[model samples]
Target: MSLVFATSNKNKFEEARKIAEGHDLELEHRDVPYVEIQADDVVDVVKPSAQQATELLDSPCFVEDAGLFIEVLNGFPGPYSAYVYKTLQNRGILRLMEGKENRRAEFVSAVGYCEPGYEPRIFKGKVRGTITKESRGSGGFGFDPIFMPDLGEGGTFAEMSTEMKDALSHRGESIEKLVKWYVRNNRADGDRNESDS
Candidate 1:
């Protein structure tokens, strides 16, 4: 009932562990960095990362890549969100949005899962919203302070509680799809054990 999550981000590890716990699965962390390949799409990057990590660990494992795509910018940082976040930060995004009414954007996440002898499977999730004029709240990380989800109550992701954000966030949606796929494919360790018994 254990699946290795290929990531070193503590925040990601915590989120993934919470999701796995909800599904009654033991999620183990493999603290290794996979070389991120430059790709046109996040799936392309995540699939290879998952495959590489699984090979290194010789076990079932998963990796995720996410990005912030601004409609106004024609997805300038779609596959380079990490770099953008590190370099520009929320203030930079707000600067980009200043005097621009078309603040439409979305956050996309791709989760790639790989088993020892199986082809990788990808699950995608997205949240649509607009960039706030200024950063709000002190919760969440990265662009959360400026990225406002359409489902939220007039505030940025950083303003929402973890429970509230998870209930309506892009990453949550991706994890839900991942859990569904695992259950459907009998890849969930608990389900596999139950079937074996």
Candidate 2:
């Protein structure tokens, strides 16, 4: 069974597709736009989106929500990371971090899956790190260049290759959980074709 990943981000979908491939699962991308609720937690934001996507597409699907939480700012853009990225961008965030002694932060990802008429199942992943003084590499997207995971060998996410970043990323961890579950529960009954919706 091929499950659809409902998201409008081609970058995110491509990253997820790579991860799913490693687990012998096929993931289809559906650019199913849904309303993201204003919630303090990524999981809360994802659940309704997942349900809404599944309903709209009439298929089993999952939605992911991620955020960058800066300790000094007390999670300034915690649940509004996308909006912040749009309005502030990395430079704006750096401006906010100026003269700050504390650089601690974390990236959190939540994946919510739902089937028709069922409650969404949520999986979460987090990577603690420090915000970079300035953007680093040119890879990845959004805040990747500005966030350095503690486990990423001191390199900002954009500084690493996709495989390297995925190994230590919040989204990678969350998607891994979802893929594992699919391997155990959906593989036996799934189709092997890969396609977009």
Best by lDDT: 2
- Among the numbered candidates, top TM-score falls to 2
TM per candidate: 0.90, 0.93
Model 1 clash pairs? none
Candidate 1 regions with alpha-carbon error over 4 angstroms: 188-197
Error of 2 at 93 (Å): 0.3
TM-score attained by model 1: 0.90
lDDT of 2 by residue, 38-147 (tens): 99988779878988998999878899999999999999899899999999999999999999999999999999888877778888889999998999999999999999
For candidate 1, what is the lDDT? 0.80
